[model samples]
Target: MDVEKVFCMNGGLGENSYTQNSYLQKKGSDMVKHITLKSLEEAYVSTTPESLGIADLGCSSGQNTLSTIREMVEAIDKTTYKFSNITPPEYRVYLNDLPTNDFNAVFKILPDFYKELNTERHLWSQKLKSSIYIAGYPGTFYGRLFPDKCLHFIYSSYSLHWLSRIPPGLYDKEGHSINKGSFYISKSSSLQVSKAYLDQFQEDFSLFLQSRSKELQSGGRMVLILLGRRDRTHVDRGNSFLWELLSRSFATLVSKGEVEQEKVDEYDAHFYAPSKNELEHEVKKEGSFEMERFEMFEIEHYSGPYMSHGTAVARTIRAIQESMISQHFGEEILDNLFENYGNLIDEEMGIEEIKPTSFISVLKKL
Candidate 1:
């Protein structure tokens, strides 16, 4: 399935990073620091490649993507001493994502990127020696995004679980009562939703491996930073928490006649949160790559009270709201909903609870 279709119904929440350029860039920079330092250390132990290149899968239109590129270039420059005998090889980068993603927005940021690089050159004589040229390509990483044996490093975050589309047999009736707010284990939730999501992830990830196995030169490395569950074998585990919260909110909306019950019922996210074991199993299944590191850690995110809502609006609340207020609920409704949701979260989790995000399962393709 086309990648865009998988993200078709996604609420604008993920896109919020496009507007908060600094936070997103900082995130990418941190990721680069972690991955690059590790990759360099690993290369020192094993056969080190003469050249290094990277691809950021799901590089959406935002500062995070640009920050990642900048960090990569800087790290490479600092690490050049490690390859003292050999000249730093040229870097070829491919930035990939869904076709609907705003590639032009990323392009708009490049001029500034060059300006920064030029500035860095003036500050550090070493920067003048590194030869790095970047190119951006918008496409689905579910398939090949580059020529055979072309990549040395690949990274993806918050992108792997989206199925190509909603499953065919699933649909909510017109009244929105039946399918309203059904998750993998809710009112309309069934094993089918969970299984379908998992099946698609496996299929898509398998294809991703097949593509990477051919694209990555021997000893190339790839890192997938995703939201992963702790237990893969837990039978009751699924998107149950999300379902519980969303269903309750929708049920409230239905009682108040704010939205059709059926409309809520019809909506289902075609996403899966794989457990670490599940992700590891899938990677081994392809028999193309070896795990270098597998770690799970959480990060804190401040959503001002909106994200706690767990309703439709929570999915799109940004760090800053500019003018897209119309696509979400009216300002008044959003305010009330967030107030209620915030109180509920405070009651349940206390005032200090932070949103948890999972880190990466770093892999090296041999």
Candidate 2:
């Protein structure tokens, strides 16, 4: 199935909702605030549009998107002070995601967001000032969403790892999954399995660049805060094996009459973690954008008030992966699956969690 049709973060403001479970992604946005601010500085000083067009691509709804937008607006405000000729920017904000995403959930929270924005505006200055207007764009980012040369800035966070579709060549001559038992590109996989995934990312990411190249005005910049890997040479085992534990959970059901082994065999997560070198290479190959900055850093996972280390880890994984997994493995398996997955984490790991590497990149449209 295409990720566009099936994938989305857990919706609503419930405990399992992405809004509650996305602590690490929130931290990611905070860690990369400098990149967003820098991009705004360059974009405003160069283009200086009276109204800035900003698109937050793959913008999963939660409390986070609004704060990020506020931060960007603050960045724009800071930029305006340095330029005497430049007036305060009126922001046209576009929040985009797949059509299946929970846009209603996103929209439902807007009154509060507007109140906060108004409060901030009043606090920032007593004078009549710039304004922000937000709209929803429901579509995948692998293709163009906006008209040519309109968007001045684009931001995507903890996305871009999702391929537009499952990698081709996953099934063999007999039409069975060749990547049996492995849900992702594991260290032990054959070169063919690895190459299949690499090819898909290459094609999808190139198409992404091509699409955005058409949308961004000259000097327009994009800041992508992404999930990535540490080693330039390999998809590290620690990074790729989260799904491995989940698959083992299915194995317990396969032992009974609960799930077919074939179902387990056919699971592929439709996700890939690329290294910084691969991103740079793709940008060079596309030739439509130049890389301004690329930094990879690590984030340590943790437990919180609502859950333990193992439970928090499982919830975090579920918020992103549950919909897809439920579609394939049956929703009935979800509770048990996560329970066993959490148990596995407790047995193998301790209080301290391994840090997952993430990347922040800034690219300028040529």
Give the number of the best model, judged by TM-score.
Answer: 2
State each model's C-alpha RMSD to the native: 5.2, 1.8
List the candidate 1 regions with Cα displacement exceeding 4 Å: 1-17, 21-33, 40-51, 168-180, 184-188, 233-240, 301-347, 351-357
Worst 10 residues of 1 by lDDT: 317-326
Q: What tens digits encode model 1's per-residue C-alpha lDDT throughout 1-366?
A: 233533422213254334442342245337546865577445423544556667888776666777667766666666664566655556667888777666777787788887887688548755345556667776777787788877777877666755555444354344232333564445445655556567777787788888988988778777777655666432322234533554565467668877665555555555566777777787889998998887776544434443443322243322222122223334444454444444444443453443334657678876
What is candidate 2's lDDT per residue for 198-307, written digit by digit as tens? 88999999999999999999999999988788766555545675667777778888887788988888888788888888899999999999899888887665646766
Model 2, TM vs. native: 0.95
Off by over 4 Å in 2: 82-84, 232-237, 351-353
Best by lDDT: 2
List clashing residue pairs in candidate 1. Answer: 175-262, 176-261, 176-262, 176-263, 177-261, 177-262, 179-265, 180-264, 180-265, 181-264
Listed per model in order, the count of residue pairs whose N, CA or C atoms clash below 3 Å is 10, 0
In Å, residue 201's CA in model 2 sits off its true spot by: 0.3
